[model samples]
Target chain A: MISIPIGEWFDALINWLKDTFPAFFGAVGTVIDWCISLFETVLSWPHPWVMILVFTGLAWAACGLKKYGLALFSLVGFSLIMGMGLWSHTMHTLALVLASTLLALLIGIPVGIYAGRSEMGERIVRPILDFMQTMPAFVYLIPAVMLFSLGKVPGAIATVIFAMPPCVRLTTLGLRQVPHDVLEASDAFGATPLQQLVKVQLPMALPSILAGVNQTIMLALSMVVIAAMIGAGGLGGQVLRGITQLRIDIGFEGGIAIVILAMYLDRVTHALGSRSARKQ
Target chain B: MSDDQTVIEARGLYKIFGSRVAEAREMVDAGHSRAEILKKTGATTAVVNSSFRIAKRETFVIMGLSGSGKSTLLRLLNRLIEPTYGEILIDGEDISQLGPSALREIRRRKYSMVFQNFGLLPHRDVTENVGFGLEIHNVDESTRRKKSLEAIQVVGLEGYENSPVQSLSGGMQQRVGLARALATDPEILLMDEAFSALDPLIRTQMQDELIELQSRLHKTVVFITHDLDEALKLGDRIVIMKDGIIDQIDTPEGILTNPATEYVATFVENVDRSKVLTAGSVMHRTPALATHKDGPHQAVRTMQHEDLSSLFVVNQNREYVGLVRIDDAIAESKKGGRSLDPILQRDVPTVALSTSLRDMIPLAGSTALPIPVLKEDGVLAGIVTRAALLSALSKESGET
Candidate 1:
């Protein structure tokens, strides 16, 4: 049977995009790079004990755990990463996750709000969101590599693309699920559209939106080792190096550090979400 | 009422729910039934050609069973649901023609609404929820707090100001909703089944509180409900809706006496007529009353003239003192008493003009003399005779 060379065509399309959108892609690369470096610098500045104290204090304050229980739990978790001697690598992974999550939220939330507010926006976004979510996470790296090249920026970009769907989906769901009567009440009170969004919709939808944020953070964390494949240095790079060199000890240590970091992020964000839910 | 006194007037309002509203409206104009239109065009007409005027400071009720569009009409008044075809005038301005911002301005400044489900922001505490309208109006924080506190007090929700709305009971949540609407002090309040979700006891209490609040605030109110008793108790005039069409518009007493349609008659039928019909409604003219200064002979003469045994005795101020019987009058006159006070029986049953027939029934049945219905000043307004009371009760029961 006569067949189209789809792979070749896809390559051509990627090349065309690179050629046509050099400035746009470069600007995105610079911004992502700047954000990642900024977070890495700040997170690395604290000594290990200082970092431990600050994070524990934050967990204690944010979650309001009695007797500093969550803070103590986070202390053990962070200590495990340091004990694995993957402290710098773990911080790099955290910087990557933070950058990607921040970027995803910045882009996703407004788009989600637009989708929530209008039928047309929802119609246009639904299939795109489905495609973005259902596409293999590895597929994102292909475009990421072509557009921004193999580095932390491309890895962060890929992570953002992979992590963003939940933020968008949950934000739309949250806003849409705001009780119809509440919206009607807001409208009857003569609230401006902007006022309604800021004062009523956002506050009411905070729990769901926070859930979306938590999911995005976890998703970005999960992308850490995978993102290491494209020159993004972190605990992910150590795991990748271990895999290529067949070093079981390095891979095990990297894996352990990633798990502890994941557990810490998961607990803290979940606690934050519950606090918002309680307020609601 | 004059146009200036009409705070809200809806003319030819129609709200057809479907994408093909134009076609549905045409079908509606062509006299298609709601079912037929829903079947043919997949359109549900929520409000159909409803027209009514609410006088200033009057509590106008729109009442109907579920799926009857009474709530739809309430939303239509505030332009929350834009009419498919028609105009609503708020203080003589065509709201349907208003742009988004202008409609919003009217909503913020001229009208506030309470919701059936309470519609309190779950994230907000009672004070924040109550102060929402004022916050929307950009009222200063101190003013908002002051006004919201006053409104909270008005709804008897003091000390609950900082409590989260979700933690409150249904009745308390609705109080917050009411307080929110009141905090704005808007000219009009649109309450869409505001207390329907509360338990019956709380609902009745809220209704009484609203009635008491209305007397003091005197804001033009458009209240929606399915409860006929609430309609009767709260409405100065009520519009009964059926299948998106207005079945009748009349005062509670007028609707009870003369239902404009069979649908309205059925609604009136289920209502407790005793609770609705008042003493003044069933009461007859006051019987011949004698002044305390009148001679006992004159009292007997007047009683003899009226061909009765007993008579109501009032002071010169027309204040009811007691009743006098012909036998006593005769005895006193034979005894040569100048004042009829000796013959007066001061313990006759009395009720007020506003007393419901349900309350007066026992008094009317137990009293030997006719029950005297008094005004606020204790003057005899009318008399509810045994025959009159029986006829009124029978008249209502016979209709159903």
Candidate 2:
């Protein structure tokens, strides 16, 4: 095949990026505004320390005292450090991750069920799924900004793009791995296909699908930090401000807050997953 | 036996698995053999032109080695899988042409099946699993639970109602499966190797429990198993299959004594048929009368006291009279000396010097005495235990 001219290829790339940029920026801006509003709502209520203590108590009940103590200490220390720099931004970042992850789950699961049941659907969707998963987090901001303009919305859109793949992939995997004998048993009982899918297949596949949800949450948390460039105000903005102004204290505080938030969400979700798995 | 009503009938049933199942069945029924049909239609046969009728409350067992298509045959009866050709009639009504809704109605009310693997849902507790069918049929929860609890008690699993099925042992899980089937109280119970997965001891226990349950419920059962012993023990009549074709269909005694083919003979060879036969195998045809004045019950009581089947049923004259069966004597006593059908001299079974216990052992449960050791004058010198014939056969066959 004849090679395309380097200048032509570069121009095509630039054109494509320019076309997608506004949607990308726009999604980021919308997400950032939502995050700021969520933080304001949370701030208008009880203190962060009180909520942290309640969560620590829950963790103690779920995972025992040692984990609870460690989690509490980490939360307090991380919050104090972030407080010295920008307290509200850290809370906004936590809200951004939570909101984006919830949105990813809503969209991912039904699509996964569709892909799992039909071979043609899986064949058609898998390549697109692969592309979404492997595309750089920074690259997602381009399309988000193009659609939603520069704000929290663009950031949330980019975070969702970056995070949703795991949920879809895991749900598909779980459904595919459901035991054939178990399916046959349901069929033998005169269960219609829909009843079998809803009652038998989904419940059996819940553990694996939950694992997907956990992964998506973590991925969204990381990507929302990257979305700070599109005027998304959060701990990510603090870290970005620290980098631009060369303020070491602000960067360290923001980074520590993100770690604390990640640990809290992960522990809570995992505990729920295991608890569900243990139930009849 | 001829007066017994038939409850289920299948005519020229064919379950051919391929694109041209209809054509294949036509070709086979039109004088072409299985091989010839296969060559023409390229369809694999599952139940090849098989047909049988099950009488009401009959424990009909389908015995076959794995892949012989006994399971396929059972599914065909309930229409779990449709047959390519044939008509199935339940109580003289053709059910093969029933639509999905009608078929579902039939299944919900008329038939239930127990799977080999004990198909209790893992996520549901025992009570829920047992009541699942009842729930699907729209039985109210309170009624279903009450019925399910009774079924659980019937299966001897009373305390395990709330336990998740995954936590139960294999035999317990199987009992739950049985309870689920029994909970519905359908007219027919179809078991597909239901006991074969259990340990031998557990299998025997389940078999005994099943017999007891059948005795009480009198549900028409079609049990499928590869074990000949199980078939003999549980089946009122057994149908043995080989490669989708039925090789034999008869009572255990009928099949054991007269195997239809070599394949069936091989299956029966290891069976200890003597255990199944009863003490009535060898009674004296003509009993000598005693000096005591009495009827058949009194004669039987007198004889049973001495462990004999053929004793005198006589009047005050002390002349020789008819023989009395010990069983009939016992029956009369149980009924407060009420008259029961007594064993006559003609009704009793007798084996001569040339006879084998292999033939006589089956009559042990009947009115005949234990095998009688006869004198040349045909007088009852002594009686042989059913065990004696078995030992003799064992010695002759070098199986002792």
Candidate 3:
């Protein structure tokens, strides 16, 4: 049987977007590059010991001091990364994750709230979110490369696309799950729609939104190594270098560093979610 | 009593739930059955052509089984549920056509509601929950705090101000809800099954507390409940609903004595009439009352004229003082007493107008003199005799 060539059609569509929206694409790339570099500069500027001190202090404050053990573990992990000479690369990965996470939140939360409030908005956004989540993570880099070209910006852009679904989906779920009686009570007490959203719905949904943020951060971290292929310099690049040059020691160090960073971010963000959950 | 005294008036209110509301309303107006309309156009009428007026400071109750639309009708008054076709006048203003901001203003200044589940914001502490209404209205912070504290005290939740609502028991949470509504100082309160979620003992306590609060606050209340006893206890006048339609609107005594429909009769069938019928309802006009200045001869004439063995004696202001027996009057006459007050028995049984017949039953059984029903100011409003008490009690058992 004769068949239409889907791959050719996809390529033609990407080419058309690149041709037709060059200025739009360029502006987006510049903005993303600026954000990523700003975070990268700030994160890497401090001496490795200073960075370690700051992160350990934050972990101590968030997860508790002597009792939880996360703070002590973070201190040891950071010291090991510094000893391994992967401090700068680890900072770059963190910067990329932070930048993408911030951007995703800025866009995703408001969209999620809109979807939560309106059935039409939900219906329109649900399929798109499903596609974004279900599509192969690598496929995001294809569009990222076409739009922003190869660099940390494209890598960060791809990470945002791959990580944003959970942020939006969970935010929508949290807001939708606010108890109906509470909303009704707010209405009964003469709360304006804006007042209800700010005072009642948002506070109640805060824990869930934080959970979404946690997932977004974790997803962004997972994308770092994949982003390395697009010339995003980080620990991901070290892993890529180790692979291409057949250096098992380099690959193993890079893998260990990623694991350490992942554990730290996951614990900190999970602690934040739990704190808010307890408050609720 | 007067149009000015009517705090809330609903005229031809209807709430039909479905997409084809207009058609459904038309069918309803044309006398189609609720089930038939549902079958035909997938429409459910929540409140059907209900009309009632709540007087100032009156505890108006709307009652029905689940799906009877009593809650919907309560929401209709505050425009929480938009009526399909009707007008609601809150102090002579038609709220049905009010814009959102205007309606919000009314909600802020005039109407507040308490929910069945004690819908306190789980994140807020008790004080914050109580002050939420004031905060929503943008009241000044200090004043909001003070008023909320006062409301909290009013609901007997003084020490729980900083306690999280989730940490509170069901009764305490409901107190927070009550305090929240009370903090607003709104003119009207719409309570949707406000005590139903509490345990039976707590529910009774809350009901009594609410009645006491209403007496002091004088806020017009529209209470919704499925419990008939609750309706009879709290309602100054009650509207019983069935299948989205009002079956009757009457005082508790009127409903008990003359239920307008079989549905309402059945609803009130199991009610302990003695608990509901009050002293004022069962009392007779004072049989023979003598002023303190009346001579013993006059007391005797009054007792003989009314064919009574004794006579109640009141002062010139009609405040009850004592009772004079026939033998005492004759003895006083023989001794030439100028006033019946010297011969009158001061230890007569007396009850306030609001005392329930159930409570007065024992007093009636113990007393030989007719039970004098006093007004709040101690005036002799009426007297309850043993015969009247027995008849009121007998009506319930006799009917069955």
Candidate 4:
């Protein structure tokens, strides 16, 4: 039996890439840092109550304004996070999630559309999406930290890679789910490929694509704790500190804040997705 | 190649679906059977050697049962499915080898198609779906809306313009599909079993509406159907397809009266010939006629000479007058009457040359004399005797 040195070869490849493209990685890090800070300033600079009101309004609108449940959930959930003295940390975690999920969608949707349109495109993209999803989040952090160094940018990059598969997969599913006869109708009408995609495919796929966005946001939030190990400060950092210092109370407080944030975000995004589904 | 009035001319059309299209096509051309070709080359030749010409403003129907290639043949006309080997000429230009952009241009400018399933966008309102084609052509918004509304009116879906397609009934949804196809005002309309999904009552109403629309619009239509009656009702000429080959191409009456093959004969075996065969196709040419100018003596002599009980009287201009029986003519002649009008029986039923045998049957049953079939100009073209009508009905029924 022959023993393979795949891990050794992969390590050498990573080192070579890091050494070869320092400038490229530095530019990417700068861009990532800029987006994350922008989100953080917007979220935290405002009084926490004002942000809570805004979020509650969004929930109200998403749930069609008659239902007050999601709105009330957001109001109470954010107040609890604030009362725990974890408001700023929660905002930072949210900023990281929003930025990473935004980046993931921007990259995922067009690639998904391409993959959905052609057999060859799908065949190549399917395995890449699988690898992105099934590979452990911590493994991505190593290469990301090596490339961009231990910072919020590297954590954000790792979070983006971990969270993007759902976006790509769901978008592809949406495009595929459009009926073949509808596609024939479009072709019969002399629609250009671009016209067909924008006018017919994208609108029909909206519900599924928005559902993908919800999944991406949830995955990004899950990455917060692992992201803290690489010096990205947020609720994850507080949780890490609580763990290292053996303070059960502090760890539990951080954990409660994360749960409240996840619950609120899920309701808001899920409402929007379901509303679009009804439209389709 | 095409003459002036030819809207579409298909030459040697073949569509073989499989990985080895070229091999399959060769096998098909070499006279191999479909099953044999499929087994040998892993290809199913859906449409084989289809060729025909469709004239402008003509409703040409392609009819076949399931798996008989009618739908595939319809798609090939517009190049929605590319042919493995063939030429489709639109007005004289071969569309088979045209590039993608050129084909798209032809589709936009020359052809608009409706589908069996209605193929409407569930998310869109009726107006938006109808306006889709105009928008694709970059028509200005106001114009597109106006044209869309006009098309909606054309399809009798006026009030449902702003309603979402999903909210409408299936019949109304297909109206939107029809309006969508009509919005572009293309020269040709391709309908692939467009009414098959509708209920029978709605399907009949749609067919009547289609016929009325054709009378008004004069658009060349290529329709496909599996229903024999639908093909008979809508087609000016129908091509019967079987096992990827055209069994016959003929008028509804021609298909019924003179089936080109045993397959066609079997296919049309159950059709009601009385409804399809016209009086012109069944009537007999009159042997001799008595003119109204001539007296009853001439009528009696002609009736006697032609060995007939009655003679149809005509004017000098060959206008139909009436039928004069031999007994009435002889009695009038014995009474010394000079004219046949006083004794002629005008109550005999008259029909147009184009009247269906179904209509002539009732008239034939009622009348003792031969029913006169008049031309459009009011001249007696021929006569449908009771024997002829029954024979026409029973004659083809026995053979088919």
- Of 1 and 3, the candidate ahead on lDDT is 3
Check candidate 3 and list the clashing pairs: none
lDDT of 3 at B392: 82
lDDT of 4 by residue, A133-243 (tens): 889889998888888889899999999999999999899999999999899988988889999899989999999999899998999999977899998889999899899
- Of models 1 and 3, which has the larger TM-score? 3
Measured against the true chain A, the candidates' chain A TM-scores are: 0.96, 0.82, 0.96, 0.98
DockQ of each: 0.81, 0.28, 0.76, 0.78
Compared with the real two-chain complex, what DockQ does model 4 have? 0.78
* CA RMSD of each candidate after superposition: 2.8, 8.4, 2.4, 1.8
TM-score of each: 0.93, 0.76, 0.94, 0.97
Q: Give one digit per residue, the lDDT tens place, for model 1 in B1-400.
A: 4544888888999999998888888888788899999999999999998888889999999999999998888888887887888899988888888889988888888998999988878888899999999999999999999999999999999889899888889999999999999999999999999988999999999999999999999999999999898999999999899899898999899999899998888767767788889898888875787887888899889988999888888888888888888998899899888987766787777888889989987776676678888899888877888888877887777555
lDDT of 2 by residue, B25-99 (tens): 677566676677778889877787788899999999999998788999998988888988888989898999998
Better of 1 and 2 by lDDT: 1
TM-score of model number 3: 0.94
Per-residue error at A2 for model 2, in Å? Answer: 6.1
Stretches of candidate 4 exceeding 4 Å from the true structure? B1-4
- True contacts recovered per prediction: 0.86, 0.18, 0.73, 0.66
Best by lDDT: 3
Candidate 4 lDDT over B292-370, as tens digits, reads 7999888888888889999998888898988888999999999999999899888777998779888776777676888
Worst lDDT 10-window in candidate 1 chain A: A61-70
Model 4 chain B poorest ten-residue lDDT run: B1-10
Give the per-residue lDDT digits (tens) of candidate 3, residues A1-280.
Answer: 9999999999899899999999999998889989999998999898889989999999988975654588888999999999999999999999999999999999899998999989999999999999989989889898788878899988998888889989999999999999888999889888999999999999999999999999999999999789999999899999999999999999999999999999999999999789889987
lDDT of 3 by residue, B1-400 (tens): 4544988999999999999988998888898989999999899999999988889999999999999999889988888889988899999889899999998998888988999998889999999999999999999999999999999999999888899999999999999999999999999999999999999999999999998998899999999999999999999898899999998999988989889899988878888998998899888874568888889998888778879998888898999999888998999899988887677788887899889988987887787778999999989999988888888888786474
Tell me how far the alpha carbon of residue A46 in candidate 1 is from the true structure, in angstroms, after superposition. Answer: 3.5
Model 4, residue A180: displacement in angstroms?
Answer: 0.9
